[model samples]
Target chain A: MTDQASGSIHSFYVHTLGTPGTESLFWLCATLAVFGLGMRLQIRLGRAPWANPVLFSIILIAAALFVTETPYATYFQSVHIINFLLGPATVALAIPLADSIRLVTKSLPTMTLALLAGSVTSVVSGIALVLLFGGSHEVALSMAPKAVTTPIAIAITSQIGGSPALTAAFAILGGIIAAMIGETTLRRLGITDWRAHGLAAGIAGSGIAAAQVAQRDPVGAAFAALGIGLNGLVTAILVPVILHFLPG
Target chain B: MPEAFFTLLVFQLIGTAAQAALNLPVPGPVIGMFLLAALLIWRKSRASRREAHSPLSPDSEPGTSAASPALAALSRTLIACLGLLFVPAGVGIITELPVLSANALPIAVALFGSTILGLMVTALVMHRATTGGAAPEKLPDTGGQVL
Candidate 1:
């Protein structure tokens, strides 16, 4: 791209969103618009909640990058404090678990088996596709934990020489996409159980779907809660073990 | 804020202990959770003693276990943190824009590919649990729509 043309595009992006809108309540507006668009599309199609929130958000962010003319650095600066909350948000999951520990103890075998399948296949397929498509080892590593919950996914990505930032994107995308398709895929395959449903969604979809499960079927909340932690633990341990065999 | 801060510090210390001492595989949050679970379990086991001095013992059972003020405060603080958790990930992307651009294909491949695969595995596991587990359960009904 020519410098003059690039400069003009940059100028256009800044002018389009209008600088004043990037501050104060505008981000909230943009956030709502982005989520509303995705939700509207989902409802229009009668789709499930997990249908790739990341995809829509990414598209919006990309558009914002150009149309708002605010540099990525500036946006990150504005949002960094909020972003750092991921750490504590994760710890907060402990609440539900502590509340339901006895229930989890009762269903340990089932939950563990479910998580085993989830954590293993998530990483294996992630690595396989990444290689099949000729993705680099770094990319593969970053994606290795996409199926795991966010906090552990970030840790695994960094440990295995993958970019954690990339991992975060992949993890969010994984949760959104999985939450979208989890229910449909279960039925097509003939799997049906509220507990299993919540567990699968929780393990695969993370907190987002888990929350939905709590609303719809409080009984299944226990299993879903266990699933979240199980998948995170299983992935954390297995991803590293598996990474040693991968190219990276 | 200080109450929340102290809760945060306690969790941070517990997380570090679990990770460093026990070689836990998951991150600080998971370790912290384990600690929290342990505490809850201990409190439950010691309900009799705790209630003697405490207000919410079996004898003083308020409708719910309305957690101690500190614990309740901690939960509130954690919920508040959820809104901004994705910021760090966004920051990481911005800081490494050059690298992200240099290898957009690989990143995209890894992301989209894993998502599709992860979705499949997730559903499969759900299926297994439904059929294999003896626990009577309801099949989630959403018409098998792959969103």
Candidate 2:
């Protein structure tokens, strides 16, 4: 088929399948359907290290959007409902954190140091790598808090003149990467304690990866929750202060 | 589950309100989480104080008060599917493909290196604090198991 003919045919298909208001339903359904399929695929794959449901779903949905020539905004209109739940989901973290308070309080000092160090390392390492790789200043800034949770990472990205959207991508990317490699790496180093594992995942991975860690141990989840909250709080304060000292 | 969901939504509402009122940089849900944790802790303390005089039993944990069940259920449901909640935003990454692609090498290197380094450093420091800098004599096959 000729390029123009294929383009016209594609447009016709989309027009026939999706109308203005109805597109929201399609996109919402598409998002969930793809996500469900991804979940099933992960389960079928026996939850292999590389077969993460979130990453799988994102790839499937993004491909669907591209094929249909659908704008991201159209898809996001309905998907945002799922996005809105992130806040409540974050609040849910307090449940695990509270449940493990005794453990959290017992090693407050170590946890505090780990959180602070992890937060700073995430910001500095991201920015430094961006610069070293010849990325622009905004890219560096956007990536600065990539290790933190999405909402806070977005907030910090905007505060420091970076793109919030990019920050969200970076946050998700970091979370997936951390969730994928965090436990295995720790084990490679002979780190066995769930507390250390959870704290590391929480600080390095933020809430998403922390949730992954939460599946292992409630005590770990509690610390992961603490790591998320404390890392965000620390990064929020530290990013601006550190930027003030840096050249850019 | 529905009641538990609503209870969490209420806590989230208070958190969002707190964020707006205080102009805090931290996300509202995070603040709300702290608030919820505090309330649960206080409730447990009160329950514990009352339980102090009663005959001690193995089943009587401080935090397992009657008021806790609903929130516990809510938290479990939310956390279990936490990965699903993040999909919309993760899908948004496609919108930035141009930027991601252009800087793909650097972004990839940075994300990969920094995440690995961050995990190692944080884990090491935590291990130091937790175990007094003692290294385990033999490595265990962590298998990256959840628990």
Candidate 3:
């Protein structure tokens, strides 16, 4: 009787795991739990510059799926409710963007010129470097928008015939790299102005580097917010226009 | 809070509609961002105008000049979690692992090299423009110290 009871309990567990609703709930909880742990680990690490929670969560969750022999499509489908919020969250960026307009308008010309230079360099250098290394045209295309925020980068990549998934990974990786080296590099280069530091962080690193800058100074935070919004707009417009003119 | 969320969703819907209608290259949410920004600026200007004309009027509330309190709160919450929103897509990288591994060298080099190059270029350009080609001015409080 005890053996039968144990066998029946095991069957119940298998049945629930196979059910669609339970599967979705299980993945959702697992993703959130892992992300929370990533956040906790970052804090425990004393907020080390390289201890990025998003990067941590992605690796852990990906490993979990891989070990379970789960296809990415099922995992993505299960957690898509979180994914859907990306659209509205992006729209919500306008609040901070609007809040910083007054402060940013003071040096509009300087910011605009810097943004244009940085935006162009980010795209051109990415593609040029990839091709110089014998990377394919498709790979080069994916590299074009690596500096912009992930949401915008994904859209731009899809528009330009690149792999959106590849671009997303590249964009996040670029942000992490920027966050790691941005401050030291800027200081070494003698860029002392907080606004300049913030702009460079925002443009090259997008949101990730900007968050790091924000932790240091409120003034830098405002300018970083400006950098993110304006750079997104500038790159969004510039990439397509550049691609339009280039011979394909 | 619900109302504010609905407001954001409405703006997103409008943006999506515009993108579909125009077949524009830009994404809908981005267009929504621009529109919402314009609306906030307009509201701010109108509020200041009201204050100028009727200083004693009760209609001229201070915090409501731009975004409403609820909307601002909601936006802040969303932006704070913005990093989390990208994780799912980033995880999609697993799907492209073979491609990534195949071209890891170029990908890594280009990502790091271009980011550093872009950072330096932007910083230099902004520093030059702001300082009028003079020596870079140190931050007053920090005294050139970067934290």
lDDT of 3 by residue, A1-248 (tens): 36676566546645775367687887788888887787687779876657777778789888767555567898889889888887787677677666656656767888889999999999999988998888889999999998987767888889889998888878878887887788778877777677887789889988777766655654565567667767877888898888777666
Candidate 1 chain A: 10-residue stretch with minimal lDDT:
A211-220
Q: For every model shown, what is its TM-score relative to the native structure?
A: 0.70, 0.89, 0.82
Tens-digit per-residue lDDT, A1-248, candidate 1: 56687778778656654356655345545654675576567567655555544355556765666554566666655555555555565555555555556556766666667678766777887778777777777777787777677767777777878887777766665565555666666666665555566677667667655544543443455566667777887787787788667663
In model 3, state the lDDT of residue A13: 45
- Model 3 in CAPRI terms: which quality? medium
Candidate 2: which stretches are off by over 4 Å? A1-17, A20-22, B59-67, B133-147
Candidate 1 vs candidate 3: the DockQ winner is 3
lDDT of 3 at A190: 74
True contacts kept of 2: 0.71
Ordered by TM-score, highest first, the candidates read 2, 3, 1
Candidate 2, B4-75: lDDT as tens digits: 778678888998898899888888888888888888777766776787777873545544633457768777
Best prediction by lDDT: 2
DockQ of 1: 0.33
Query: What lDDT does the true structure give each of the candidates?
Result: 0.61, 0.80, 0.78
DockQ of the candidate models in sequence: 0.33, 0.54, 0.50
* Total colliding residue pairs, candidate 2: 2
Candidate 1 residue spans exceeding 4 A from truth: A1-47, A50-58, A205-225, A243-248, B1-13, B16-25, B48-84, B87-147
Q: Local error of candidate 3 at A22, Å? A: 1.7
Clashing pairs in 3: none
